[model samples]
Target: VAGLPNNFVFAQTGTYTFTMVTDPNNQFAECNENNNTLVRHITVTNLPDMRILSQHIAPSKLNPEPGEPITMNVSYENIGQSNINQQMKLKLLIDNIPVDSVYPVNGLVTGGTTTVAIPASWSSSLVGIHVIRAIIDADDVVNEGNETNNEATRSFVVGSSANLFFNQFFASNNIPAPGDTIILTARIGNNGDLATEADVSFYYLNDQLDTLLIGTSAIAVPANDSITLTFPWKVINNSTVLAARITNASELEFTYDDNRATTLIGGPPQVTVVSAAACTGTDGGSMTAVVTGGKPPYTFSWSNNASSQTVNGAAGSYSVTVTDILNRTATASGVIADSNCCPPCTKAPKKPSLLISGMSSTGATNKFCPGDTIIVSVKIPDPTACSYSWTVPPGTVLLGGQGTDSIVLALDGNFAATSNIYASAINTCGTSAIGTGKLNRGAKPGTPGSITGIQDGLCDVSGVTYVIPTIGGLVYNWYFDTVNTATGAGIITSGQGTGMVTADFTSAWVKGVIHVTASNACGTSGARKMTNLKPAPGKPAGITGPSQVTAYQAGVQYSI
Candidate 1:
């Protein structure tokens, strides 16, 4: 291998050995024969070999709108036997002028591959085909296997564009009244290569989308074209501002600052209350409210459950409110009457005029029975104006409702043939005139109460008189026990048909039971029973021997 070429290359990169024999022909003798040979081994390999595998433009091989950013990508691999230890620069160039740089293969190992990406924006003025290149180690700074294969190129066209924006916005009128209808219009511009659709939306400045939806209009415009959109708006009370915005465009846009606009809107509703009237005596006066500046059909509501524009009743303060269709409200309040306060009006209410209406059971005779209960009701021109009190005879017992419009009384034995009851109405002002009615106790006597005087027949059972007491105005029938009487039970005796009885009891020393019945105009009463009747104890038997023995009163005592 003498005189080898200067640019010699290894056919196959690997380790090689070179040997030199200093005394191969034995031209000189050496002390040791084994030390006559010299040998060296070296590895032969190519330089750091790198090659561009692919060049790409993002949205590859297609046209992009001017002013849009584009991405340039280059893939490269280290195909040599040596590894690269330094940072390698991958540069992106447009028309052979460096535009961007990136390190694609930093410390690349043998047989390694990597890709570098560069993003660059084109000016809107660019209108033709552009040459973009990606170069690996472009400055020959890296000793690669092949220097000629470091760069990659690609070409693409810059096309036109479409941008959507709001150009003009206006309203039909700046000032609107409550409940007025108005129109709003917006103009949109499309500055691009194709037709596209966009949303033109309307808004009330301070209202939410759900509460005040002015509505949205969709419009399609040709490239480099403009369109007008119109919408209807109803003017509401207290509205101050309106706005329009363009949104949801179907294509890429050049700018967004001009897509929205706002305008001033004026006019609001107003409300007021007018007058309230005073009250007079027991009657209530009215109050009114006046509504001026708001949408109508106006409505009225009063605090007293009255739906009319005016309110009335009872002396006191009153209030009323009026509302318009737009929901604007006003209120007013005042005293109905100067002197009338609630509860006990300033001037005391007039006393009730009372009259005796009738009794519970009054007929042509105006009569009632003993022991009967009757209700006496009184009449008053104004029942609620005052309280009532009823007065009955001294012996009459008032059972219930003594001091009310009516009263109940029990007719006891105290009631005579004729009696009178009185009633009167009373209030804070004064007592009403007296009212009276007469009540006649009828002839129906109650059951016989008791027999007052009774005695055993000391003289004889015959001609004995018994006095029986019973309710007045009624007759009685007496009954006697048959064992004591010679006649049958219930036989009317000498006192028959009267409250007294005289009978003869022939059965000696026997108990007698007596009964009596009272009858009147109403009917006969239940019989009353009386027991424990006996003839006087039989005359003691005459004592004979005992009478003969006598002793002197002062000095002697004798026992027989």
Candidate 2:
């Protein structure tokens, strides 16, 4: 063979010509002598060799949190024109001891290269820096071009989890009345490994259960520490409920329910006579004071000689007064007359109480699809003569019967995951309690954005780390381009399953797209880099030493 390795060995170091002949023993005859014999020039030297090219281990993160998984990858090649059919083992070692072994390489042919990756989990106790090693053909099963280049090692650090939570809330005055200002304070704690920034928000709801959005506050909280926030709320209604909520935290938390706290504040009180028996010719009359609003422990005083608000008197006139712990009082008086002269007289009727028994959807299975019409019918109060007003959700339109009890809503595509409707009835007396109905718009996910970061390393020597945008997702997948495969054939490696990745960018150095897909129970959203990979800056072309140098004695300064 012209270019094949010569297996024969010569005793002396010299150049020689070797001749080959067909049927040298004359056992067979050839048609022509010129074509039967072939001669080749040969040199007595070492044979071709096969070796391990290189190996690499990718640490998922520079400082990975405890319990996070890390991966190790090794790349090897057959440098010689010989196939490795012998049994060879690629062993993964920790501190030079084999921890895992990969099976025999059966058909590693010439110029062939392959990569082997192993995944390992980090324990909670695994802190500080640790070294990982990937050794190919560790037992020296097959002869190689270079025996010293079989193992590659890498180091990484693992830390604990960073968790932040809402701790407690305090109000300067819990029983603040309407038109009064109360200072509300909330506390946030970080029981985690690293420092983090927390996003905090405040909310308030009146006695009617109508929620109001207060402004949000952004604060920084160090690890294993806590901070308190304060907000001044001008009381608008009595019996108001206040809450402090924290969401979109920079650090991942083990639980989210503890991120909110609530407290209730008192308001002005209202008193009314719930029951009043009219005075008649045959019997006396009695009345009881019904009190609402304000704080509890109320007191009642009747205008009659009786100490209590409930009193019995002859057919003349009587009055009652009600008071609360806050000293707020209400008075009401009624006239009693003979039944023959007064024709069953009484006070005006009270407001009708509103209630929503049920809400239905026209779509399939009571679920509203995108662009579907949702019809909400409130419990209609009969001929009592009361007006109705509905609090519609954002982007909802009342089609008909707005002043009436029933209304229709045309659901638009921008409808959020949940839609709520509140109805309140009002008449001459007072406003009724709010009635509510709700509908679900199915599963949904928050919008995700893409980001990019360059890693420290050269194109040919070390891999570049891309800091993937971390969006809330049940699972994450990353895809990178190796060539012009931006659209069709570019996927070189993937299945990172994390928010960050370290890959060889040399293959797609100048032009590439890193596409990340985030998926959950709802669906998936794909994020792609807006532009090609940016080229790393080259090293400085020239360098020089310090121009001026001066030496000094003890206690004297030296300049360079």
Candidate 3:
């Protein structure tokens, strides 16, 4: 059958008339001309349905870190009965805003699909629930079975941010005299995994706790690092509390409870704070003001520029002047001292020790087979600032972790059976005592020397006494090889771990071989064969030679 082909699409659901004319302009005259003139009505119920197959963030996670680079992966497919003859558009949206529009290079047929990836707009400051949407056939270029399922939306939150903290708040000069500038420094520490930027604001509080903003600084702090910001503050004004805080961080509200510190000015406030015991080492000593001799509402002024009752100062001599409400003044002097204020900060670190992985506890006995690599580490407290030294035995290769407490030792088949590993800890102060770790190598043992036994004992009824070179701490197992019409099951009578033994070979063939192996914690070695073992010769052939040779009868020897 043959027919003329034409391309057209019915957009509406209702059916319409269709007419065909053969050579309407007399372009061709054929035998089927009358049949081509016939008209037919066709129903257009099947339509193309373009739908979003999938839309998500690549390297998907429930919550990604702020400013983390990410891309949106989206795909669309035609799930309808009919194929689309024209290209369609795909639109991507972020938070309901159209950010990207793409077109299919070719028409989409039934079950045809395409995918696209778009880089997302991410910023360190944007930290919250976000939206990503993928819309297929956005231009409605292709007639579909359903249009409602053309888009997909996803929402995700930017992670738990880095923990930024104000670790240090101090000043260059706590007791600044008249016209002296106090350099205030704030140390910010990030204990989290994300870097962030923030503004650190400095302030000061007067005697009445009246606060004043000194200045603000914008700085960047990296993950697990710290940065210091400084601000020059002048005018002690008799005494005032100086402090700093991280108020704004990446345009996000920080959830730290202790983000702010106040009344942190250095040096003790004048007579306002009554002296207690002198402070010892670094901070942590407390003092309270017990003003009884002054008039009502007394005001204290300190050379350290402290308006509050308490302040911080290095170990040294301090003086302050106090005034009553009526303007009467008095002065006092005190000293802060500590023997440990600075003692060269001494003491050597503890000795280095080794710990093997998979062991129950440190210093536990372990076995290492031939061609085995073992992870040996210093079983000591971590985060300790120090170095280490390790010493390995002969025939052992140190794989790594040298010049440190831990190490990797590769023991070969010919490695020594027993040895010790020496190590030590070195610190700024001094080197620690050398430590020791034992190695019980399970290397293959060398073949035993030729079987040594008394010639007469070899055939004795009491069995033969055989021995091999004794290795201090290994177990020797002896066995016999099967031969002839029978076999000899050598019975070891004594000295198993002692390396010396007596075996009874009375029940088997003379052609059998006695083999022994050395074993330790690691495992057993290969066989060391001892051949020519047999019971004592049959009573020396009834002592025929001895009968002819009597005592003092020379030349009386005879053969049987």
Candidate 4:
């Protein structure tokens, strides 16, 4: 009652003053003080001191383009002896020339700071450096004590600014062979007085101008200087165009037209290739090529110098290079397996792909619960010729489909474990790479922590609060007399499906209990019971005052 306002009643009075309180030894503490009264004083200055504390221009920029609307925010303060309540005029000036001569200002409280705005936007024009000024009380409206600090000024430029563009593109091999290493150079230049940081993007393009951005390099372009960026590039086909550009130029840039340029490289002519594998009882193997496009009458050079349309070799890999009449060359290679690779002309199975639950399963994911059945499958080139074998995590049971490309597994419910389920595709020729899926044991929410609240709640009391340690993603349900006693407690008023609850107890409740359970998509946890709960006996009836005693009498006795 000492510090609480509007509470005038006091049981006993000696002296009191307020002090902050904290838990001492976490158990017991009391507040005490000893003063009969307190006093305070108030004072203020009478003269007002007005000044423009600070001002800022919105869309702050070095060189805002002509006709770009910009606003100014001016902060005026009354650091004075008295508060002003009447309207005052603030002025906005460009180059000390008032554009807005009478922008109105609402008054400020004593020692208070406030912001005001002009009703018009100022467009930066007339390309040159200019001054922006915010002057408060320029006409002596407030009769302020100090008049020197009524204005603030800032400077901005509308003239020369940072301008970067592509100067020229150069390459060591403009007429380069396909797949030849070409030294590419992109020259970036700046024409203004401001330096800028930019990125030079290089792209590989076809005659159709279809582009592939290969890479970019960070460059610092000095004002009035040119810098060359170099990168190693290769042409993929004839008429390949190499392009370079300056990306993310500063807003102060004059124009963007010259920021990018392209140069075309003439790629050399080439040929296509095809080869045959060795057969059981024929020439071991052969490589073949013919000029399809470009100059005809193509010539072939095999690794063994068997220069012709076709070359024969033993069971192995062979390299083939071809040159057209213009001597522009192309390279390729082929493999010739042993003549006995297959009796029926077939290849062994390739690596098989596996999935769980019809898709790739991330390792040890909790999305699947224990006792859940999962489908495991594999895909191979020729499923009809391949048989699969499966292995699962320990304690899991394989249901069926082990010899085929798919299998079913029953997750072990008795234990939660993380492991992979693997399968292999087998053919008469060879076995394929092992395909794998994974599983993690998921289950119902664990039993919740103890319920906490007043152990012996009063009978017939309403809105008593109880709470349990919260488990995220679990729904909690609370009930009274869940053990089925006649009147163990009363109704749960609110906070169902949450970690806390409030309830109203029955007047006759005794030896009651609070029961709570946590549940989720998996299942419900066992009930957590708060036992040994009983209401304190209703308070004893109040004593009655007897016949009234005379007023203004001292020591008069009354009987109960």
Candidate 5:
């Protein structure tokens, strides 16, 4: 091989060595003996080479959502054997016109080149199609034999960033309960040239109108696409008015013009305590109240002229009022209203509401073991039509009375029994809440003692029977085998008693085996084996004395 000529204006060319080898018989005697007769030739050609030297963008093109930071990718490639050293620069261009800014490029390439990032300001004006070009220059190479100053240019279009937009914004209720999570979803759209990252935030207003940041999240929106972003805001006990906002952090700066949106926050509806049976009483009674419409955070107070009764603070079906705040004023009454509002302005109940006070059971402990019977009974108002239903825990079966207020359950394995009681006032409009009782069965012991005394019989033995020993509180299962022709196999037998079980085979046989198993509440015992049975009796034979045998032989000898 030979190197091509470097500076030829016309077609550049280079020379290559050729070799010839020849047989000794065909060569002339005077010719050199060391030279070969075979001939081969090679040639080299020179051609001008051009390749991308370097590329870049003015502003670094990166993961910018939309209309944020302008993104550009600069690249370079080896054009000639000479090493290229230069300061590369990138510019954003629209319709062949240079954009406002320029990004400087810096790196070295010996043989191959690489791409680099260029940062620039994103432009909202360049909406549809825009091009960016990277210009690279050697700037210093001037020697004759050295490679000429090289320049590389690459063009690309800028894509629109992602944008968020919504049709409408609203909140279900402004006032949320403490520890409650509120989910707010916003319908968003991608309006920019490229996809953008959307962020949703929830804010709450303090008494000073200052917004307290509640939550924020990053959401993905495709270019020219729309999606909904859901954000959950946790409610604190002291929270009052809560609001929400959505933004798209694309390009570099946040875009609020076409994508940003907000919603109005409100409080929970007001709850009114219509009337409770008696806030203070000797025996526990029900408290009845009507929940009025208002924002949440409503407070309730009851008066019964006694000091021992108290009440639950939140809104619910029942509040345990153990103390009476209002002393004896000749009249006992209670007031309920929004906690933030003053008295009288809040709605209060006029009369006491009827409520079932107590329901309980005493027959069985809450838990039981498998196969153990449990009796469950509950106490409710005497005149009410009360019904009971039993729910068995997983891996258990209820023998009977599946849907009854009170029932007996047999525990099996690790299972529990649950009873739900439903009561209705004889003529009341609403039914009372269900009361539940649970019975748990602990772990079960290992299998009980094994069966014993199994026996085998011979072929032609029509049947074989064995009595199972009596085992108190233990169950027994019997298995037997009979011989057919030559082989013996196990057969399940009927009429197997629990305590004393007897197994019978259909055909009598020699060499048969019987297995008996005993079981108890804990578990089953190992089986016992019996082998080898006596053959059945056939015809009977008679025996004679020695003197009778001799006389009979002498009398028979003369005739025979």
Candidate 6:
């Protein structure tokens, strides 16, 4: 906690002591357990030991100009007995209320001085007494024995310097032409106390003004002193009048002088075109005029100038004589206005329209496999004496005849291959619209091949076997015909065979017929059939002789 009251104000100069006490509620539990209260002492003395030693508010008055910087210096001093470690802060108050801090208080030592700059916008109003107060706060003291708080306040007035003045001026022409140099001069002076540095720029306001010569030094003038500077300029071309003026000027901390002035320089005499015209085809054009100097009310006349030629538009150079307002006459020459003749109108030959006659594949019977080569030809209409250009689809391998109507193509792995032909004919005019033809490769269908040697029999017994036959490029299918009505007929079996066959049956007495079919990619072949059967076994005859020989003992040798 601080030792001073929150709102304490000191009026008289005296030494004041304060004591800072630690919070009583916070206690050390282990060390110094019983006596935990801590207190520290601080002292503050109200003293008027710091003051504003010197202050200079620039111009002494306010000038209402945009973008001007105002500077003020508040020189301060530390008159206290003890060294002060606190910074001497400066605050600018408009009406005893702080608006901005010109210099913040920090890291300031005793018996030192500093300056603060206040911008021009801070005092932008008209001429008036702007109470600018500089307050110095001594918030830090290094000596513990001297308990004193030092502060000081001072006020100054800002005056107005609205009158414009020149600071530094010069004139120069980087490059001067013959007989066109102009002599220029400038003056720099200050009406205010503040010192300023500025640039006096020169520019050509009128094209007729004399061109500024080279090697002109910029002149600098001190406050309240005027310097008359002069330089030469050059005039080029036939301008009647020339002008020069000051372009820019500036001042430091006090005011800015944007004052400008222009002067008229020398130029060439007057040149005039009295009359001008364009001539008809084959006929020549003419113009006449009178040249003049020294100005107004000039008269003009031409020698041997034809009015008919003047009336018609013609192209060529002509001359004339002119009289100035001052009664001075001279000869002037100028070109007559001419009409540009367009090139001779020749009718452009009409472009022949592209016509597609027919598109056909060059392979035999127009048949092709997936990766076979095929040629495509597109017939273009015979446009007499006309140029033609042919175009084909991308990836179409051109074996021969490119830029013509026909191009050969190799089929790709895709299902279909097509060629588009663009034929255009060009003549004297523009090229015609393209005509295209599409050629497609034929697609072949897939078919199953022949199935041969179908046979069926009872289950679990050897029976007739059938073989399924197929073409080299075809597939096969096999089906069996059964006689049992309870079970389903046409039982399919699994065996892909070309010539050999074998079969087995589950039962001995069952019989059936087996059928086979085969097919290829184009079409299915005819069905083949085989029959199966289980024959009955012959009965055994009774035992006769051998039974009778052994029947003596058996008595009744009946058919045993």
lDDT of each: 0.62, 0.58, 0.60, 0.66, 0.43, 0.43
Please tell me which predicted candidate would have the highest lDDT against the true structure: 4
Where model 3 places Cα greater than 4 Å from the true spot, the runs are 1-158, 251-254, 266-560
Best first by lDDT, ranked: 4, 1, 3, 2, 6, 5
- Which runs of model 1 end up more than 4 angstroms from their true locations? 1-158, 207-211, 267-560
Give the top-scoring candidate (TM-score): 4
Report the backbone clash tally of model 3.
6
Once model 2 is optimally superposed onto the true structure by TM-score, how far is the C-alpha of residue 125 displaced, in angstroms? 11
Per-prediction TM-score? 0.23, 0.26, 0.23, 0.26, 0.21, 0.21
State the local distance difference test value for candidate 3.
0.60
Model 4 / residue 352 / CA error / Å: 5.4
Model 1 scores what on Cα lDDT? Answer: 0.62
Higher-lDDT candidate of 2 and 5:
2
- Regions of model 2 farther than 4 Å from truth: 1-159, 267-274, 277-289, 294-560
Better of 3 and 5 by lDDT: 3
On a 0 to 100 scale, what is the lDDT of residue 512 in model 3? 56
Which digits, one per residue and each the tens of the lDDT, describe model 4 over residues 201-272?
888764344688868888988889988889887667544557888888653565555788887666445555
For residues 275-364, what per-residue lDDT tens digits would candidate 6 score against the true structure?
444322222344544333333334444443432212222455655555443245566666666543322323432333333222222223
lDDT of 6: 0.43
Q: For candidate 1, report its TM-score.
A: 0.23
Give the runs in model 5 whose Cα sits over 4 Å from its true position: 1-369, 373-463, 481-492, 500-510, 534-560
Clashing pairs in 4: 45-81
For model 5, residues 359-429, the per-residue Cα lDDT tens digits are 11111334344556555544433232222333455645555433233345555665434433222221122
- Give the Å error, residue 373, model 3: 86
- lDDT score at residue 257, model 5, on the 0-100 scale: 40
Q: For candidate 3, lDDT tens digit of each residue in 1-560?
A: 22322235554344677787756887887766566576787655456677774333332453567777555667777777645546667777767877767766345677787666654544344776667778777866554557688887766557665667878788787556647887877778886666888878888765455677878889888878998788888755534556677866773322354467644333332343444443232332334344544333455455555544454444455566666543556666565443232223267767666676522111234656655567777887323324567788886788765554567788765667677888877655677888888877544455555556643334324435778776544567776675522443455544444456666545343545667787654566777776655554534554355544447766765564
